[model samples]
Target: MKKTLSLVAILAAGTSQAAGFQVDTHSARATGAGGAATAWLEDSSSIYYNVANMVGVKKLDITLGDTGILPSITFQRPNMEAEGQRTTLSPPPHLFVVYKPFEKAAFGVGVFTPYGARSRWEEGFSGRFRGYESSLATYYINPSFAYELHPRFRFGAGLDIARATIELTRGLDFVNSEGSVHLGGADWGSGFNIGVQAKLLDNLDMGLHYRSAIDIAFQGQADFQNIPVEFQSRLTDQKAHADVVLPSTVTAGLAYRPLNNLLLAFDASWVDWSTFSELAIRFENPSIDNPLPKRWRAKWKYSLGGEYGVTDALQVRLGFTYDPSPSPNNTLTPDLPDANRFKVSVGAGYQFKPFRADLGYQFVALADKESTAPGMPGTYSGNAHVLGLTLGFNLQ
Candidate 1:
């Protein structure tokens, strides 16, 4: 029972909590700085970022977007310390649709990868001494509706269905004469999202959206070969039944045209990271230690960003955000090296009448976190770079 509870807390929050953990400035207008404006989602993207903004559309617009994320990590466990890391490539894509079927009613739909990333420590990597590899993938399908009530008033709603899978390999410190085992599992879940956007005034806009929490139950088994005994409690063990929680959040933004061609936007948001404070999974086939410790806590995230139009055909954006690590300093694990961060981003777009294209780039510099946990060890002093592109076509 102690082992099961311990294992659950070790992997829950970092793996399942939905605390806006990603610093994705995917929109050209949102990335230029770091997504400071929530009101700009008026475009087709309102489906993922803000459904209330869906009413900001005047015609039928469809958008296709993609972003590539590359990150590096380091570790300083109670014993040894390693630094400066490089990870493989993970690409995420998005698609959005908005149409004013009638004058007062608008329909929207979008497909995108909301929260995701991949972390792989190559063979011989230092962390391998503890447990060495992890990768996660996830996506969502969003369908929504919006209606314009008055000249500057609009209302909207959204529905989201998400799916995910993962492949991982961790090292097990051995004690006795037992070989270490490799552990892994895959699961899926479903959930819903609701939102509202209203023009607080002519130059100020307000938006709020929430994604209901979900539970993904893993069903796959694992393969264990050369394992270690000391770390066998966590690594060599296999889980037949386990469940993870995906929380929810709310976002708000404003857009103001400070100049004739210059549009300024800023956004503020919050997430429910506390739902993951802990987790305990009871395997259908109970093991010695069935329920483990999924110790995670509530976290908070906020962002500020804006966009400017250089000309009728070109526009630029910039944003910044602060993300707090939900994993406490005491229980920090290698499966997820999460911590607070200060993000900087830049992006631009080109508009051609009914055709528009956007591109954005971001850099994440870690805020110093010198945590010397027991199992995982490392001084994480690295950064991450992200590239995003979006294309939009209006079916007028």
Candidate 2:
């Protein structure tokens, strides 16, 4: 039982879906203009976007910011259906510091909601057979430093001290009983992050970053109340154990400004979902047909955004992104409810001396995807929509 719960949490795929466990945490000033801040990062937000850029400074700098993700989901199929619904507010906030304690070098530290998110469904959703209710959350604090080998080459590294929690529930076998069974519990782990940025030419810049995967091996207790009395008594151990393998990923991209005040950026990233197979747990031995038999494949996602300086203090940004699904239809699980997605975003920012404000909006359309397990009766279709907001400020 413990193993099953742990698998559910580690395998809870959608926890950070902008890219597996990635939400692009940064200042709205950066995101407001579609991450064009790569080369133009003359602000304190550089602590997260690109620490090396802090070399632009001559004074002490500080930044504080926050963003929100509001997602809506829906389920449909020949045999089952549910109304579209929106998730609760996922508020992510960040703080950054850059101290030019010495010339040609910058020292910094920050606390932010770097990676994590969760989803929830009503008790009677159609895909209950695969997963009923799901919940996950994570927080990170990083103490970092960076140096400028020269005006064009900058590098940075940091340790990610993270805390996470997971909760899961799935429908029980009707032939077996009533209501859904809780299949997961909360657990925590830690990891690291390393990244670099380069200015090869006057108008071109590149960035590379890597995030290590964290394994949440959880231990807990569980029991099945709906099962027949005989089976319940025989399974009295109640101890649960599971090893959840999340994957490490890499991202590389470029930023270019075509016109005097127009900036362009493109980023391509890889997420290794292949690490997930059948989320197995052990009793005396592993169950042949664990309610969820998932096989997610590795995939890549890319984004292109542009920023235009409307005026010295205000700028407008717009962009589009396409992401392929990691899970095949046959292996999809309600817990992950993932699909290929298309997103469109627009935002603007205004800077007034030492203060700045950013506002943005986005719309996401999900492809119609399905999931069907052999013993799980029928197939189900899935879909969803999402909108987000970002706000930021920097001061000396």
Candidate 3:
């Protein structure tokens, strides 16, 4: 029973749609710019990237956006190869509103998906016992306020209310017979974020933002099927609980305008993945209690993006990012075959009076990873295509 229940740890340590499963597609403008708009205060998305920038809002601004992610992954071992079977698109949405009631103060709210991922493997795959299908979704609702302290400096803080859901399916080993187990759960958590934005020079701006970690207590059920009659009594369905701590992050960015028509931005982020060193699960049946070690390490991500005004109402953008995986090779598993990633993106935006629209596309490529973890030994390779669209309106 312990062996069979060990696989459940993957539910909390699953594959990430983005770097370690953190989603950065809050706005099409930022996405097209490779997510480097931390200091480029041009849209309401500032409520997510750097709330301090909200002080720049002239009056009232609202932005709505969505991103679709399509992934293709493959795993190979010796003479056998299996293709990931997930075919559906994962779409995460974002909405932000900023209102400036006075010259020095602004209020804003944002709703977005900051972390989520989905993975599916073909039937009869060698790693089915590890994890066949899994999905995780997290939502963050933030309400923030910003104030201009100095003429060129602004500071802000926000409260983060988060909700998360998880579901997973894995095959159960019975030697000669095949069985399966499914787990599902939901939980709520809270955290906080603070940011500072400063205008260093007429053409340069700097911003720093920090988000605290959140702890979620999940309570759910585990259902088992096809258990042999001999072991049915021991492996029956039961309740389960787990404690998971989401990582915190600190990001710094600079936006520079070298040319009157061109704006360039760069950002660096440090993720405290070390906080997820282990996961402890307590089942209704004490016999199945499990503690899994993750040993994930902290990592850094870098992004560079540029936008050029093609005309008074049209703009073109391009961006690039390098994100390293936090999961170490020793503990890597089939459920989340994490690896370093490189991304390239391009987009365009148009402004029409009180309405604006932006479209962006990005391609993510993961470096092939060779894993020798216990029963699953293979080389995993994958890539994803992401497309995003955003619409904005200004009410004065």
Candidate 4:
């Protein structure tokens, strides 16, 4: 069981749908606006969006937020009347704090889960050869600083310390038998983020942000359970090692306020998922080393969102987003099933004295995808619900 869990983690890390499972929903306000915050951020959560905007924050502020992802994934194969498999949900949480003791300089610290999710398939499912169960998670601890270059422009940078964990389980080829392998590991890596924000006009602002890629080397032990008598000795109690790269991304956005009580924002983002070209696992036994191909390509996403001030202390929000898949048909497996998708969201915010709170919800629908891979023929469909909450407090 231990080995099955560990192996599942490494393999599952390679299969993600949201910008390659990068987790774009960080702040409830930004999520409610369909992830268009770049220049429209006002709370300390700006630490995760555009670091340059940190200088625009008011006094000292801190925010705590969480996003829950509930996904329903199903698969159907040729000539099979059996029911589809369903997946489990994973939650991502975040915390951020920002302070500006000087007129032109600001600093912040944050802890957040930027990438993670899990998938599980039914026993004896048609796609058992590809994957049975897996889970992957990543967390980042960031320390950031920003400077107001001028009255209208700001620049910022941050250091990212990241930690990742994985567990995976999959079936093995055996005659009329139930045999599986488990793998698990954990590691830490480093990366960086940079951004620039400018007030283009009195009521218009523009921003650009970039997050660098992180490489992690996961080392752990693998266990072969219920293996046939012939394969048991060679596969059990072996050491495992895998090197993986988390992709990089760039985003640009604009925020415009035509009326004092209304704000609009739009964003375009590009992710370089080609970095995740393959997954190679090396065992203590050199003869067992193998590589898994992952020919993912770069992809783009667009979002638009709006907020209206309904009263002095209340605001309403709405947003929409379009995300295209990067995985190709030939390499598409049940483990990492994916396709183009759309997201619609709604949220509201209210302020009570020195504290402000916001809640947002999003509905995700993925386009159906079919595969004709030689012996593996199947169709995958999925939908998800995302809910986010953010709480902010002003100390100064």
- Provide the TM-score for each candidate, comma-separated: 0.86, 0.84, 0.95, 0.94
- The RMSD of every model to the true structure, in order and in angstroms, is 4.0, 3.8, 2.9, 3.5
Measured on C-alpha atoms, candidate 1 has an lDDT of 0.62
Candidates in order have lDDT scores of 0.62, 0.61, 0.83, 0.80
Show pairs that collide, candidate 2.
1-240, 2-240, 2-241, 3-240, 3-241, 3-242
Question: What digit string (tens of lDDT, one per residue) describes model 2 on residues 233-300?
Answer: 44443556676655666767788877889888887777777776666554433442353456667888
Worst lDDT run of 10 residues, candidate 3, spans 1-10
lDDT of 3 at 75: 77
Q: Candidate 3, residue 214: CA error in Å?
A: 0.6
Lowest summed lDDT across 10 adjacent residues in model 1 is found at 1-10
User: Compared with the true structure, what per-residue lDDT tens digits does model 3 show for residues 184-213?
Assistant: 998899999999999999999999999998
lDDT, residue 172, model 1: 44
lDDT of 4: 0.80
lDDT (10s digit) by residue, model 1, range 1-396: 112222223332232112224434445555665766556666888777777677778779888877777766565544554644445666777888898878888898878766665555555565554345555555677788887778676777777777756555555445454343344566567777777667676676666677676666666455566755444465444555555565566776666766666666666666655655444434434553333233556555677776677887987777776766666666555555666666777888898878988888877776556555664545554566778888888766
How many Å off is the CA of 347 in candidate 1? 1.2
Ranked by lDDT, top first: 3, 4, 1, 2
Best by lDDT: 3
For model 2, give the 10-residue run with minimal summed lDDT. 377-386
